[model samples]
Target chain A: MARMKFLCDAERCIECNSCVTACKNEHEVPWGVNRRRVVTLNDGVPGEKSISVACMHCTDAPCAAVCPVDCFYTTDDGIVLHDKDLCIGCGYCFYACPFGAPQYPQQSAFGVRGKMDKCTFCAGGPLADNSNKEYEKYGRNRIAEGKLPLCAEMCSTKALLAGDGDMIADIYRQRVLKRGGRPQTWGWESAYGASG
Target chain B: MKTLVSTMAGLTLLFLGGCYESPNVTTYEPGVYKGPKDPLMMGKADQRAETLKKRFELVQMDR
Candidate 1:
């Protein structure tokens, strides 16, 4: 089984935010829930770059490890999914996530954080494949449908690449070589560190 | 007494196995911005808001 991943080339990203929009639309994500976001680094500077951020679906996902109810689970393709039914509305996953991905809708009322929601990597949730319930709660299960994420496909500049880890990395490497920009070590260092 | 010792040993292993090491990633620390101006800055600060609005509109249509 291939380990799925998403790689956003900061050098190639035009900050158009097509990825963010695609994610929200595909999922019908609520007003306060952002499945994807663009973070502009060195804004208004020479090296101004915007990277689309979402759940990275890590090898040893902290969210999955920290979930008290064990709602989160990793698929063969490395997509992290969770059962909304099993979620206890605990905010541990939110705190454990490095990318600030997990979001709780009930945070506004009574100071109680709701069940955590994050990117499903277009694979939907723990619900049965292609079910309406899964679509309503998570989003489209494009992976099961033999398709990639809509965000990467909708990217006008082709900045966000999603597929097998090696394929996406190769795409990013080619872009970096063509653009004459060195790859930044920040992503892995920030995500898992040297020991990881 | 033998059963009690084994139970204690099992509990210790369970607790030790669950321990996770923290990564060295920088936490989000809020602070005041004090930076020099950039001459090459091309757009207005409000551009982000405008872009976000357009993105939201696109998302609304997809749903």
Candidate 2:
């Protein structure tokens, strides 16, 4: 199975936030609970750019590592999912995640966070494939349906790309070669560690 | 019995004082977002552009 991934082209991203709206509409994500968002750097600056941010579905996901009940799991396609039932409302995943992907409802009076939620890469969760349980917990199983993530598909500038890692990397490489740009050195190294 | 009660009380105070250290990686500096050129010593302009290109590739592959 091909490892799934997401790539956001900062150069091409107009920060239109079409991807963010598409994801929210597709998932019915509650207010204050955005599964995807556009983060702008150097807002109002001449060279400002916006990059759509969400779960990268990393190979060595930090959230998965810190989950107390082993709620998190990775699929053959490289999507990271979790068992909501098994979650214990711990916020370790939230603190550990570099992308700020994990989110929890403020259900408790003392601010005891609720079960963690994040991007499922549109593949849903540990619940049975395409079952009502899965849909109820994780918006949709688009990957199982052989469909790409709604965010990437709805991207206005085609700035957000998602799919097989090799293919995505190649596409990015081509763009860089064409534009005479160099690779970023911070995020992947800091989040995943230099060894990666 | 008195000593035991005092010890318990002390422990409770320590725990309830929000002094319990978390096991999670606490080295993270919240509200401090890092950019591509922030560390790794790469050229700022080129790094940002490259990072964007990488992100684009990921999205494109799924297409």
Candidate 3:
């Protein structure tokens, strides 16, 4: 059983929105909702870095912790997912999440908020795997189809590695070793913890 | 006769409204649309092999 994980190498990322576009295209995400995006730090400076951003699917996910309706759950493979039907459109998860992953599609008059949407790790929601309900509410179920997340797969430079945590870690570790430098994984410590 | 015809017309409008279909009810089996396969997909096996080979080549270069 692979413990799915995502590692974005800032050294290699060229600020291309290919990963962001791949995710949106694969899921047919709504116009207002972005399941994934690229965030660049430092503008017009020497050695600027950008990394694709989405739900980190944290080991101890704060989004799950803050959901008052108990809509969130982690899959066996460690993918963090939430039940849109059960979700009450509360923005608690959004405030709690460090990555600002959870997004609401509609904010109508009179304090109305639609269901919260976030990265599904391509595993999908509680709805039947690859079902229409799942696709409409969540996105693609590539994980159930024996495929990794499209964002990483569609990466042009292979900067984003997605697969078994152990496997990709080894790959990343080797690259860092060859380059002869400290492993500067930007969000790893914040998402997975410093020791993790 | 006027009351009878008016009642009948009202009932017919009610029936038509009930029969109206909603567009939001979409099904996956017939409705799911897939785009073209990614040609750059080196496939899963190839992706794994490529990563592993790169790791080993790095180690060899280090040695």
* The candidate that achieves the highest TM-score relative to the unseen native structure: 3
Please identify model 2 stretches exceeding 4 Å from their true place: A183-196, B1-63
Model 1 RMSD to the real structure?
A: 17.7
Docking quality band of candidate 3, CAPRI definitions: incorrect
Q: Across residues A1-196, which tens digit of lDDT does each residue of candidate 2 receive?
A: 4677899988888988888888888877766777888998779988777888989999998887776667776665567777777788788988998898888877758888777778888877665667787777788877655567889877777778887777778888888898885645336874688798
**Compared with the true structure, what per-residue lDDT tens digits does model 3 show for residues A38-111?**
99877568878898889988888888776776777665556777777777897999999998899988768875
Which candidate ranks first by DockQ, i.e. highest? Answer: 2
The TM-score between candidate 2 and the true structure equals 0.70
What i-RMS does every model get? 19.4, 14.7, 12.2
Model 3, C-alpha of B34: deviation from truth (Å): 32
* Candidates, ranked, DockQ: 2, 3, 1
CAPRI-style quality class for the chain A–B interface of candidate 2: incorrect
Q: For model 1, how does the per-residue alpha-carbon lDDT over B1-63 read when each residue is reduced to its tens digit?
A: 999999999999999988966688755422211122211122242443344234333432222
Candidate 1 Cα errors over 4 Å, as ranges: A184-196, B1-63
- lDDT per residue for candidate 1 within A1-196, as digits (tens), equals 4567888878678888889899998888878889899999878998788899999999988887777666776665567777777787888888899999998785576778777789988877766667898788788877655566789777877778776676566666666777686766367754697688
Every model's TM-score: 0.69, 0.70, 0.71
Error of 2 at A51 (Å): 1.0
Binned by DockQ into CAPRI classes (incorrect, acceptable, medium, high), candidate 1 is incorrect
